[model samples]
Target: DAGVTQSPTHLIKTRGQQVTLRCSPKSGHDTVSWYQQALGQGPQFIFQYYEEEERQRGNFPDRFSGHQFPNYSSELNVNALLLGDSALYLCASSFGTAVQYFGPGTRLTVT
Candidate 1:
């Protein structure tokens, strides 16, 4: 049984550019949550989607958006990227409020 997975393990972008990160949840999971982790800091919740709807969101700005597909996969989009946006984006999947399983994360560098 494969766990959650993310794509483009590493990415480089420039300020003012836009980027989209993809994630696939583990089998049997229906909820996906996205987080941003800065160097030497704990992960900060970005948002979460369930049933194709945004169930919750964190303190992130509107530039951060997400979508959850019927198949339980999700995507995170960040627009007008800033150097501060450079961090490890993580995807965690869970089953109806259960424990979440996280992916290796996507490292984004905004220069």
Candidate 2:
């Protein structure tokens, strides 16, 4: 079976622009988490979605949001983007706190 997959592996946006990143979880996974990774640093948890509702969030501002679909796919939406938002956005799918399967992350650049 295939692992997690993401769309638009690379993305470019300007400050104040909004972007949406999509992720299709591995088969049978129902929960999804989003993370942001800056250069030279590990991934920072953004938020998690399960049962179509947000279950947890990290230190990110309200500009970051997510949704989990009934089918278990998820989306990460960032509003009022800033240059500081430039980073690799990752999508991880798992089963209720189980080992997460991560996708090849979307690299976003904000100018």
Candidate 3:
């Protein structure tokens, strides 16, 4: 019955550094999706994972990647971070095509 959860509610990083964000899907969910929300902008889908494999990806560069575990938890990794990478990284969970439930997200500040 637990809802989706994310770690390190806030994070700070420098340009060129990498960061990894974590997420736990809601109970009974088998899919996880990652999103990035810039200041004053709506969430943009980064990628989605189901069955422990990436099911879909967005228009992001190769620096963005993700992994989903058997337990339905997931991790998002961003390499060669840039100033533009600073944003709220959101994790959403869904059971099939149903509505997605989002976590509060990890605030990433790239300087």
Off by over 4 Å in 2: none
Work out how many backbone clashes candidate 3 has: 0
Tens-place lDDT per residue, model 1, 1-111, is 999999989999999999999999999999999999999999999999999999999999999999999899999999999999999999999998899999999999999
Candidate rank order under lDDT: 1, 3, 2
lDDT agreement with native, every candidate: 0.97, 0.94, 0.95
The candidate that achieves the highest TM-score relative to the unseen native structure: 1
Highest-scoring model, lDDT: 1
Per-residue lDDT of 1-111 in model 3, one digit per residue for the tens?
Answer: 779999989999999999999999999999999999999999999999999999999999999998988899999999999999999999999997789999999999999
Sorted on TM-score, highest at the top, how do the candidates line up? 1, 2, 3
Clash pairs, model 3 backbone: none
Give the clashing pairs for model 1. none
Off by over 4 Å in 3: none
Quote each prediction's TM-score.
Answer: 0.99, 0.98, 0.98
Give the higher-TM-score candidate: 1 or 2.
1
Count clashing residue pairs in model 2: 0
Candidates 1 and 2 compared: the better one by lDDT is 1
